[model samples]
Target: MEILQIDDTLSLKRTVDGGTEEQRKAVKAIISEVRAAGDQALRAFTEKFDAVKLDDFRVTEEEILEAYHAVSSAVVEIITEAAANIRTYHEKQLRPSWMTTAENGTMLGQKVTPLDSVGVYVPGGTAAYPSSVLMNVIPAITAGVERIVMVSPPGQDGKLPPGVLVAADIAGVKEIYKVGGAQAIAALAYGTETIKPVDKITGPGNIFVALAKREVFGDVAIDMIAGPSEIGILADDTARANEIAADLLSQAEHDPRACAVLVTTSRTLAENVLDEVYKQLPHLPRKDIATEAIENFGAIYVADDLEEAVGAINQLAPEHLEIVTENPVGLLGKIKHAGAIFLGRYSSEPVGDYFAGPNHVLPTNGTARFSSPLSVEDFQKKSSIILYSEQAMNENGAKIAEFARLEGLEAHARAVEARLK
Candidate 1:
């Protein structure tokens, strides 16, 4: 990992938020074509991108059942267990329709309504992320979304991954398609003859998919324009350098562009962890990818004090922040922004990525400063319901009329006056 000698305030103004400009332009073109041509364009694009032409894109009930059977019984149990945990965590987030009444008979409330339909995009690139399938689908199901449509690229055999299909089943996803890349995103945004358009789409994909979601955002709601995964480790003299090195390696393995950074007040600890990172990288399965990440984006920053470390972390706004220092709680209040904060050495990024009930789909590339991880709330809508009694209208109508007239909106003023009169 590169050591950034920090002597002044860091200015990271030009960091790429999501993906390259090429990805954005390519995805926008696909979305535009899909919007214009509809299903016919969908089929053509599917054939060209996915390398498989389909008579129908939507999965049948039989397909879901078959998918459940296709996977090992052991794998099925794992997916099922993960689903239960995810459900338990999100159940608390369910928002109920509420009403409030005034003494003068003015009542106002919001109706928490589940969306009619939603879409999920699963990546099928270098690896299949079944966890993402669960993370995206369960929340929509918990929100009582009526229909959940999913799309992922098929393998060389032109069939969806068994793990993805099984996870979808566990999460109560009803419709899935054998299409992926930007084209799949387009098909979901603008309905194809076979792939129906959905109200919203969730889940993570490659840069192309992220860009496609950004392009079709107004047409269909998306979880977030997610970027590469990242982690920030705040360690002190109390922490073990080996353990800290292991934690940084966990995030480095995600992608070459992924960031695995270490910020420490002790120069000795920082140097030890750097030495340990080299020792541990070779044994890892994705060492090649991790090595690239560590070589480029990965950093070991030596801070003058703990406060300086926190200040740098807040500025980075990493997807996962690990406070591995002494008295992690004491420093907790110092962290102003992050996608998810892992306190103490035991609380690693992997714990949250798997097993833990928290949603792993997080904001990336410093977007956490403004965005949040995916949750049940992302799938639901809120509608305000208001009822004013005649007496209440009489009490406030003159003031309302005057306020509207002050804005030079005579029609608005007359509308209230007519009701009061």
Candidate 2:
């Protein structure tokens, strides 16, 4: 890891991969074909990309029962507990429809309604992301969405991962599909023979999945165009060097493009962490991936003061921010931007990733500056409510017409006037 002085020139701005022209063209073709041929296109794409042929894309209840037998009982219990924690957290975010009336007999408020249907895409193949399943599905279920569907690619054996299946079942997702990539996204958005279209699509995947989400965005709601993982640590000499190095590598192992950064007031701590990171790098199973990330995107910055370090972290707006200072909570008010904040050394980033109640589906690539993590609000929408009694309408009808006529909307003015008693 490189150590440098904090300066205005230093930036964590990374260009997001928008995919090559060829890949974008291919995604558009896949979406078009899925819209045109429906289930036939889905089967053909699954065979070509996943190297598996399936007459039925849906996962049967028997298969789900088999998944329970495939995994250990302890794993099932852990997933069930995690699901409970996630549900408890998101249930607090739910809001009921509300309205208010005044002396004028006018009612105005907002009605909150959960989406009719949602599709959650989990990446599959060699690795299974059970956490992704919980993080994306639980919030939607908590929001009371009627139909929740899950899709993932099948392996060469034509079966979804046991852990992924278990997680989905625990998360209260009744529909599971054995398909993935751009085609799955298309099926979710346009509807196939077996899979119905959803109002929104959420979860992360490879570049093709991201591109497909981008292509089908306007037609259906999408969570966000997520990039690789990131972790930013704000620490001082009081923080342990080895622990900091280990936390940084936790995110580094996620992807070659993942970024890990440390900004500290003590120069000695920066140097020590730099050494510790190198020492620990060789022992990781994903050493090749972590090494590439640490070599390219990892950094250690020596700040003149705690204020300067916090300012630098705000500018970066990392997906995950960990403060390991002597008084981490005292510095909370200074943080203006971050997808999630972990105070003190004990609150490791992975705690929020898996066991913690917060959603791990966060805005990446500096989007934390404007966006937020996936929440129940993402699965529900608000509709403005307006009601006017006859007396109220009579009192304001002329003014409303005048205002509308000011904009040369004669029809709007007439509509309001016609309702006036």
Clashes per candidate (backbone, < 3 Å) = 0, 0
Off by over 4 Å in 1: 7-14, 17-25, 36-39, 60-70
Compute the lDDT of residue 223 as modeled in candidate 2.
99
Q: What TM-score, over all chains together, does every model reach?
A: 0.93, 0.98
* 241: Cα error in model 2, Å: 0.8
**1-421 per-residue lDDT for model 1 (tens digits):** 7666555654232266566777677778888888788777777787887777776777777777787788899998888888888889999998799999988888999999899999899898688888989998888889999998889987767678778888887788777888888888888888866777889988888878878888888978888877667888888899999999999999889888788888889999988999999999999999999998888878888999988888898988888999988799998888988999999878878888866788999988788899998999999999999998999889889999999999999999889999885
Instruction: Score candidate 2 by lDDT.
Output: 0.94
**What is residue 110's positional error in candidate 1, in angstroms?**
1.2
Off by over 4 Å in 2: none
